[model samples]
Target chain A: MNRYIKLVNFEISRFIKLYFVLIAITVISQVTGTIMISSQYVNSASEAIYQHGVSIEQFITERGLMSMFQVTASLWFLGPIALCIAALIFYTFFIWYRDWFAKNTFIYRLLMLPTARINIYLAKATSIFLLVLGLVALQLFLIPLLSTILKWIVPVDLRLDMSVTELIDSFFYLQIILPQSFVEFLIYYGIGFMVVFIVFTAILFERSFRLKGILLGGVYGILSIAIFTMPFFIFIDYLYPIELLAVETVLGLIVAAMSIWVSHYLLTKKVMV
Target chain B: MIEIKEITKKFGRKKVLNGVSFTAEKGEITCIIGVNGVGKTTILNAIMNLTPVNSGQILINGEKIHKGSYENVTFIPDAMTMLPQMTISQAMEFMQDFYNTWNQKRASEILGFFKLKESDRISELSKGNKAKVNLLLGLAMDVDFILMDEPFSGIDIFSREQIAEVFTSHLIEDRGVIITTHEIGDIEHLIDKVVLLDQGVVLKEFNSEEMRETEGKSVVDVMREVFKA
Candidate 1:
């Protein structure tokens, strides 16, 4: 377990340096956009309440309602997309440089370590999970900060008409509900993808004499995806009842289990030094 | 403490090891001398269970070695086969974390002996230094047997001499060192037994004193005469 942790720590330390740059960019863009948009909302709210003689409570409710949908809808798209791209890049870095890293003196040194191979695999998985989780958390924070800044910048009269608590409540609810579910879903998805990728590469490496492993892995991965998705595609037309969440969950679990088992078998038996 | 019996391996249709049989006693250096492509490395790998032999029984300390018995053996392949990406320290740390037999003090001493910097990545080192580090790690492991495939192939003459001395001084007293190499001149004095291989078979096996007295020549000279014959 300690060995696994060390491996995880090593991976995270290395990755954070690369990922922080992207985070910085995200922070700047989100903060700027929030400030700009909030100012507009404030002006619009003030004009509607004071100039048009609209009731303060109704104006506040209206603006809060609008902000709820707008903020959530934007985050619903941006958060997951940003996280997925970052996660892909992180995992891809490992795939791309595996051979170079695998054959290095460092790995030779590492191979001699008294740790189990499973620990190494788990370490990588944990690092990837943490990275994805961190990105999601950052995005979640951004949504609220954006909402607050927008409320502050809006005209004073408009601010009086709106219920800041109600506006924040909606944002928080969407932030928790969507991002939490999305992160969980992606965790499973990412692990499945990683298992398949690792196994394919390991098998290809064992079969070939050169660096053809990556190419063969890509080909194998595509074939596996096709095979795995065939059942879903075939049954797609009859999937209208929508309450078969239990069935869907069970099937997903089975597929993930099978993929993991296959990867474990290939990695243990087929991989060569 | 290691035994190989009737082992044969093939790459495609080309037979590499053909019914090769040998035993390596504890606390001795066994040199498997052969021409290139004669299954020297294959035999070592087979003993380590790194490669599957088509037909054979490899027993380490009376237990058969397979995928499960990997913990009992440590393999030091040719210098070229060493992982090139790890820094000396990172490699040591990894080894320390994995193997029960990892001796950090011994490894540290060896690292200090070679003056290997902690931050110097393996790929950044010269070929000889890389070999030195490889040998250092193999020697530090507290295993029953150490199988080295061409440990000195690409190393320099001076470094080879230093490595030979290190092998003799540190290795020969307590553990088995099985080495396969074409260059037997430098290691001639260090080896206690010689297993001469030709075309995938063990042609001869003789101890150092017996071979010297009977043949009136060193292992290198005997190799030349045997292969010539």
Candidate 2:
């Protein structure tokens, strides 16, 4: 168990620098974006009301604060969110491949460790999980900071102060990131873990068999997705919405188990350093 | 005792190790010598279970080798096994963390003997120093057996001498070592047994001393005869 922790920490150390860069990119782009858009709204409103001799009430009523919020979310937040997701997905494969493709074959050392080989797999998975959660937590903290930036740029009278929850509910992606309830959060992140595991298993397949493994990995990935969602398609019409979710969750767990099992077998029996 | 019995391996349709078998007991150094493209490295990998074997068993002390069996063994491949970004100290700590058999005192001694500083990053080290670090990682472990694959393949003469010095040192005294190398000159005197491989088969397995005294032939002489035919 302690060895697994060390393995996890070792894995995390490899990518922690890149992770920080990702965070910095997210923080800089999103904050700058919020400030720029809010400043633009304030300047445009001032021009309409004062320079053009229009009423402040008419200006405020015409461009609703809700519209300002929507614009800010769409223009700035979405890009960073998408970028984070894409980077993480790329890293899921990179974490495994980097060890093999690096100047030194770090995979050899990892495979020869005096613990169960499954610990290596679990540790890498845990590190990816921790990274995703860390970024999620960072993004969650940024929401309030961004809201403050919006409040600072736009005057009190012109601003509509919405709670963080309200802001999250307003956007589709935000809702996915910061789900309404704990169960929803678990379900979302569980799926994320499943995706990471499936990709990891695919990479193991590729590594073990070389060119043939590439084809095998792709097929394995598709099969994993199918298995995870099999319950949904099979009982879509017969089951209630809640029952469907329950069955889907059960199937998802089974798929996760299978993915880990296949990965363990490959690592132990087939993988070559 | 380490017993590899009739191990067979293939990559695609090409057979790499065809029914290869050998044994290395504790307190002896076994050298697997063969030309390039032979199954030298693959044999070590198969022993460590780093690569799959199609048929046969690798037994350590009468039991089939398993994941937990690594506690008794360590492997140093031809290439650097540590991450390039890691400093010597970090790499040592990583080994210490994973293997309970890790001996920090011995590791530090080797570091001092090799004149490798703790702050040195693996990527910054020369090819020879990288090889030293790889050797240090394996030698520091208090295991019964150590497997080295082409440790002297690419390095300066000075580094090769330094690495060869390790063979005579007390560092490897009682351990069963299986080293794969075509260059047999460096540790020729240190090898107790030699297994000559060619075309995925073990052509001959003989005691080095017996070859020297009775057979009146050097490993190179035996190799010339084996490959000539």
Candidate 3:
């Protein structure tokens, strides 16, 4: 357990420099975006009421109140979020590959760590998991700051004051990230965790077998996806909606368990440095 | 003892190791000598479980090798295992973090012996210094068996001599050492046993002293005769 945490910490340390850079990008891009969009909304509102001979009521009805939903919709806001997501996805594979491809091949040290090889696999996955959650937490914390930015740019009557929940509800992506209910959060992140494990196992397959392993890993990954979605296709006619969800959940768990077992086998018996 | 019981390893269809077997006992130096592509490094990797074998078993002290075996057995590959960006001190700290067998005092001692500063990044070191650091990391571990893959392969004469001097130094301290090298002229006097391999097979395994005493042959002379035959 202790070794696993240290391994995770070690992995985190390797990526921390880039991680902080990612955070900085997210902050700068999103805040700049919010201010820009909010300023545009307020300027248009002023122009319409003051110059175009429309009442504030007409301006409100025509342009709508400046809200975080509108502010969050801009490319400035979504682009950074997309970039963060893409970066995390790229890192999911790079985390494992970096050790093997490093100047001196740190895989040898990691594999020869005198602990169960599964600890290394788990620690890597855990590091990715922690980093992903860390970014998500950052986004959640950034929402209010975004709201504050919108407030600072637009006049009070021209903007809508939203609670954190209302802002999240207004944004479809935010709902997916920090789901409204605990169960929904579990279901969303649970499938995410399983897919990450499957992808990690696939990478190990490539590392172990090289060219032939790529085919093997691809087939393994496709099979996992097929199994997870099987209930929607095969049992849709017979199972209730709740029953189908339960089936999907069970299959997701099974896939996760299989990936871990295969990963453990590969790490211990088949992994190549 | 670190015993390899007839291990076979295949890279795709090509057999890199064809049922090769050997043993290295504690307090002795076993040298595996072969030309390049003869599976010398593969054999060492198998012993350390750096790569898996298609068949047979590896045992350290009469137990089947596993992750725990690393505490007692360590491998120093032909290249450094630490990241190039890491300083020597950070690499040592990394070892200390992962291995209970890490000896910081001995690590410091070997660093000083190599005349290397701890603050030097591995990437900045010359090939000879890098090889010394590679060997230093393994030797500093209080392991019973150390497997080195060609510690003298690309080193300068002075570096080779310094590394050869290590075989006779107290820093070795009775650990069983299995080193693979294509050239043995420089350290012929230091090896206790030699396992001569050709094309994935062990051509000969003998005590170096016995070869000199009984056959009146140096390690290289035996290699020439065996390969010629």
Error of 3 at B199 (Å): 0.6
Worst 10 residues of 1 chain B by lDDT: B77-86
For all candidates in order, the CA lDDT equals 0.66, 0.87, 0.89
CA shift of B152, model 3, Å: 0.8
The order of the candidates by DockQ, greatest first, is 3, 2, 1
**Candidates in order, interface RMSD in Å:** 4.5, 1.1, 0.9
Which pairs in model 3 have colliding backbones?
Answer: none
lDDT per residue for candidate 2 within A1-273, as digits (tens), equals 588998898889888888888898889888888877888888999899889987878887788762335544665767877887888888888888888899889888888877788888999999989998898899889888888888778888888888878777877777898888998998999898988888889899998998999999999999989987886778788999899888878878888888899999999889988
A1-273 per-residue lDDT for model 3 (tens digits): 389989999889999999999999999999988988888888888788889889988889888887888867788888888998899899999998988887788888888888999998898889989998999899889999899878888989988899989888888888888888887888999999999999999999998888999999999999999999988888899998888878888999999999999999988888888
User: What is the alpha-carbon lDDT for the whole of candidate 2?
Assistant: 0.87
Q: Rank the candidates by TM-score, best first.
A: 3, 2, 1
Return the TM-scores of chain A for each candidate in numbered order: 0.63, 0.95, 0.95
Q: Give the range where candidate 3 chain A is weakest over 10 consecutive residues by summed lDDT.
A: A65-74
Off by over 4 Å in 2: A66-68
Tell me candidate 3's TM-score on chain B.
Answer: 0.97
DockQ of each: 0.26, 0.86, 0.86
